[model samples]
Target chain A: MDNTESIYEKSVVPNTMGTKSFNIDNLFLVAFFGGVIPMVVLGAKNAKWLNISKKLIYMLIIFGAALLVTKLVFVAMITSGSLDLDNTTLNISYRVGSVLLFIAFKLVLNKAFHQHMVVCGKMEALLKPALIWIVVGIVVEFVLVVAVSM
Target chain B: MCEEQYANDRKMIEHYFSMDRYEDARPIIENLLLSDPQDPETLYLMGVVYLSREQYTEARELVQEALRNGYNPEYAFFFIGLTYQEQKMYAEAEDAYLRSLEINPNQANVNAAYGYLMLLTGHDEKAIKLLDEAIRIDPDDSAVNDYVYRFYLAKNDGSNQAQYLQRTMEIARNEQEKLINIAVYHLVKEDTKTAEEYLRQLYLLDPTNKHVLEVLEEINRTNHMLFLPNRLIDKIGGPAVFYIGFIILVLVLTWADINSIAIVILALYLITAGYTWLAPLLYRLFVKGKI
Candidate 1:
């Protein structure tokens, strides 16, 4: 091959498909308001956009389920007088739990999130989807908490 | 000419262009164009020469002609973007950059250029994402590093600014760039005496650099002691710091069962947060008259 042809080959990359995903900052905002459920749901959606492995998506769901179960168990214990915790301590524990879930969301999807931003350079707005998910998550969380308490 | 001879001539032209000896390459480029006026590669290289000479109209026409003749469309579009940007035709520049990016989103230079355009147009959030992507794609690109450093500097994000400034310093290609980075490094480190020394050297090298003069003036105007509070807040008092601090305060109050003392501490924390948010703005207004 000629030098010019070789240089062209080196410089030109094959065109790949680009897909838009929700911004990580918006996902963080969802997590702050609606906690683990909506965070995992939105993260899974982003994983789909990024074409992340299905196995990683399953792992994320499982991680979120485990955190929810632990929260439910903690609530049940508190309601049954088995673990006597004051209001201040309970508030702190809830904050810590939310933070842990948020960290997990970040760890599981950080690479894909950055890759999406780099490749797409634009993100789908999260407002409508985030609202729907957060409302659904809140209702389900409320029901589970009430059931656990009973 | 034989094919091999033509290849050798093209190689020689490329060598001259790479070394920034556009004048030396011009005669050969003219000959190649004279022999085969429709050759896309020759047309593109001639476009680059025009671009270097600030002949934007000729550069754009040649690049577009190359694109029509099936040259690398992504690179042609990127070159078109650069010409438009130099001419301050921002909307056309953005369109050209988007076209280039649409063809190959992985291009680091296109991403950085688009990010800079976004920054100029006041779309800061989008600029941050695009610039971050460019850095991820090519961390060694000094131009992109400089843009990110300047972005962080404008936001008063001292940690990020320091990080990119160091990267720019490490990859500085020329003496002027190296001198500027070193001076800014010392300035950010609050070593005004050392920074002034380097800035003076830079001033002697390039008397037309207004940034050097402005920084020197600012250094002369402000007392370092009075600026300490503002600098410290900018350096270590971002939102994440305050949020973590508040979390720790809550944990401490709960664990220690110090309700009465907690009120005083919380009030003090609020005051600190307020000061952290306001100190830089107040300093700019009072000291620099910038805002």
Candidate 2:
């Protein structure tokens, strides 16, 4: 009982409230990835598992385009010196691009495998990509948290 | 025998009315008015025509005539209220809306308008209750939902913020409008990254959007401030950091002293700015490539 209590005190007790010392801004960085990581993993995993190369490409392109645009916009805003704390356009773009990419990737991969390739027996050949995509999402989110908190 | 003709003309009158051809509907409605000058439906049509033509005074008169002639007056009352609202006569508008509610409480527009008036008059609690009812009755109405969302935001009631924002998002038609709510929610919740994502999407979707442009700039500045490196600033070295470099350059014209400080400061500034600029770029270029 003493050993168990000591372990608990050293480990879980400190974080019982699940609140971090990070300020509100840091909290935002964590939350931003909350939506992002899921989208990324789901997107990549679905593309691989479904064998939807075209759709994957579309997703990647949209994602890249969105990120690129956001980077430019952020730079411009900072230069101009009129940054709002509650700007929502960033989140919306990520979500929109993620969704469009998901649909496009899934459809294209399914079509490619089903139409041109000669898969004799598997109905679920693309599960690996889907699982990997989920992992990627988690990792991305973790990295974002670290970046903000660090 | 006259029933068939009455039905035919009523249908034609309604059909023309629905098509917004008020002038075309006039003859049919006028015949009905001639046959039964006290006809509520006929009076209502006449009022509508007058209302469409910006003849508010005449419309009010006709609508009142319809009410006195034993017309049900619910629709007429709604129009009268609308006229009063357009005229900016809040008191008269409120009275008409109250009269409308008395006849048919299910009319969500009346409820919403009444709530708006109450809000304007500083009866917040009552206005919110009425607006809540209005939303309940017409969940699909974007205008009413937006009003409620703004109300909660104004009150700084963070708890209900998400729910109202979600409603606004659901009803928003365009990507730009949808981004506004997403940004606000993430912003209030202090989720800057997600807020940034939404802002980015808006910028891409509509580069000319001033709102998105403003937010992008804001987040970028905050991100820079939050992530700035103390080491980079310190590299500027003691007294020379702010003034001595400039002073030495102006007074002594010593190239070495000026060059050293200038190089150090310039390098530090570039590295700081570069890191600020390149951090996301590097993330997107190398790390996010897989995603």
Candidate 3:
């Protein structure tokens, strides 16, 4: 069938509803943009299907603290005039380190939290918004990286 | 009892493999191999596990071993084709898939695989034919239908793209694929209005679908479609032209006594605006020609 005919069919096609569609790709995309945090909070807020344990939160806190310390050290080094790295190099390293830290924190926390999941149902709806944000975030990040590197 | 145990082990392997627990399935395959290392079926299953993990080299080796050890050569060849496909060795994949097809002419997957390879190599006609055959072999198989639909989409078979995309959605297993396809269906149909709707629906379904978002962005940015400018001109052009012409007419009427001076002034205004601005505006208004 041609697109035009199909479009016509779409208009006339009767409603027989039951199935729900969830966008998995979008869920992944949103994760990149801090969309994952809110999404995970909502998904776990009920604690029915998946539980977010205190240990996972502690791990995240530790990761955040470590990241803060790293930044402080870098700043101290720059202020003390001890480190002799070029501005571009230092900035790139800082940016990349921040990204890596976040990735590591996420991976570790995800492993901790998702591993003990109770099989409740699909998580697509929860994840979709986050995924879109993630894609947008990645694109922006990529553009920034290219600009910065250049 | 031992035979039953062997069968149960194979079943367990199959179950784990299906669930994508390849690591869990590996031990079972190893146990089966312990009993009879030459077990063709076990070897084939092992090969499939590797294939699923995208371990192409090991998959090819194991599948070839399965064939040598007298497994279902049809499936073994098909798996070999799959491994080759993963490695992007299209010619080898084609040869392996064809060999499988020769053994089992009605095998849907072999035909589908071959059809996909044809698409990769730009053999559109052959790809469609093979995919059609796959669909013929398994009419109720949504995946095969999806392949056929996507094949048409790749060929840019305008109407067919819509039809198959719709069909693919109808039998689509997930809401996400269904939503994405609906937008795609409208998109291929040149029904941008509907396409954007579905694309938005797709975003609501799974917001991270960059492809859907990108397509939506593309559609949103492309407002100056060929018919749009003409329609816009039809709506406002008459009044605009009349008003502008009236001013010019008045200028000529009042300045006919100083015709040479009036003509020069008009020419100056036209030249100043025409090449630098009006021509570009008109070009944008009419064809939306872009660099």
Candidate 4:
């Protein structure tokens, strides 16, 4: 059917009972904006360790923390492997994980944060290490999404 | 005086269009048309806005006015063709498409539309050839794939249908494909469980997948009776892990109910704290300092 016809059908007979339609393109767009772009922006602007060059420190802190947390969750889930897909337990776990990933993404855009601060005259010194944190955040999110889905 | 007023009118028309306030654009465009009744650009633009809103009759009149005024008549033809298609006037659509193609044969949309019109007219072979030509010009043309998919599906030739469906999936280029392909593959293999699992994932990813909606309804109605046999969860190591954890939790709860509850609550708290606080502290202590 044409997109117009499909749209008409959807509007005329709205699927009121079920979840909303998910377009992969839409999902990817959401991820790019909500997860990726913000992370990149934040990573570029943020400073680490009261200096601009210590970005690596920020990267390690976020990634190490996220990785360790994900590992623990994986172990728990593996150990208690249950068939209760009905429970919101997995959903909660994933949402929390995704949010962590989001924060990591923000770290990647750390320079953007630092730059904003600098522009605002809050920080006189620019730390370059924050850039590494941004890269780490982006990589972490990319890996986690692929790993979890797989 | 005339030149300046007309320029201002055009500017005002563009401003309203930019703001996406089409209702506001109408009076300005109409006034422009009244002042300079011979202006093709204003007529064409008015047609375009109306066409976007699916106001076919008004769009047609405005477009024809542009054509009559000797403006870019090919675009007028194209929009008229699209409006005809919207109205399901396939014969008129085909003629208008042909007219537009005659004017601008190189335009991908014209070829794609002509191809789609042919498909709707049951000229499958011609439609396919035209669509292929369009694809060669613009490989990502949506209308061409949509029409071709429709044609093959109607033909009910399994292999051909699958082939076109695969094309559509590729063109779709979304995460939805991840769920869709897995579900369909399992369904074809008669592995209902795996199919159902993928379907569930598909629903979670995008609840709007019509095929998934249908399968979910069928499964629910049958009370999950029609199951695909192949086990994907095992291959992925998800099912086993989930089952083991669930069984252990159940056993612990059954024996020392109160103690298990307390332990569960404590464990939850510890896990949350570790993820949010302790883990970050350890990272800052060791990895952050080192790296």
The global C-alpha lDDT for each of the candidates, from Candidate 1 onward, is 0.73, 0.59, 0.58, 0.55
Q: What lDDT tens digits, residue by residue, belong to model 2 across residues B1-291?
A: 299999999899888775456878888888888888888778988999988877888998899888888777677787787787656565677678777878787777667776765554445566777787888789888767776776665455677767888888888756667787778667655577899998898788767566578778767755653344533333563211322343344334334556666666666655654564355555456644642
DockQ (C-alpha based) per candidate is 0.04, 0.01, 0.01, 0.01
Off by over 4 Å in 4: A1-150, B1-28, B140-291
Regions of model 1 farther than 4 Å from truth: A1-30, A42-61, A77-88, A105-140, A147-150, B1-245, B266-291
Runs of candidate 2 exceeding 4 Å displacement: A1-150, B122-124, B140-291
Q: Tens digits of per-residue lDDT for model 2 on A1-150?
A: 223112111111111111011111111222233344444444444344433456555666567456535644654564466665333454444544444444343344443333211112124333344345456755764565344434
Q: In model 2, what lDDT does residue B278 have?
A: 55
Q: Cα deviation of B52 in candidate 2 (Å)?
A: 1.9
TM-score of model 2 relative to the true fold? Answer: 0.35
Q: lDDT tens digits, residues A1-150, model 3?
A: 232112111111122211122322222223323322333432233222232366765555555456445645655565567777655655444444444444443444342232222111134354455445456644654564454444
| Index of the highest-DockQ prediction | 1
Residue-by-residue lDDT tens digits, candidate 1, B205-231: 878677789889878755455455545
Q: What is the interface RMSD of candidate 3, in Å?
A: 23.7
- For candidate 3, give the lDDT: 0.58
Per-chain TM-score of candidate 1, chain B: 0.60
Name the 10 consecutive residues with the lowest summed lDDT in model 2 chain A.
A15-24
Top candidate when judged by TM-score against the true structure: 1
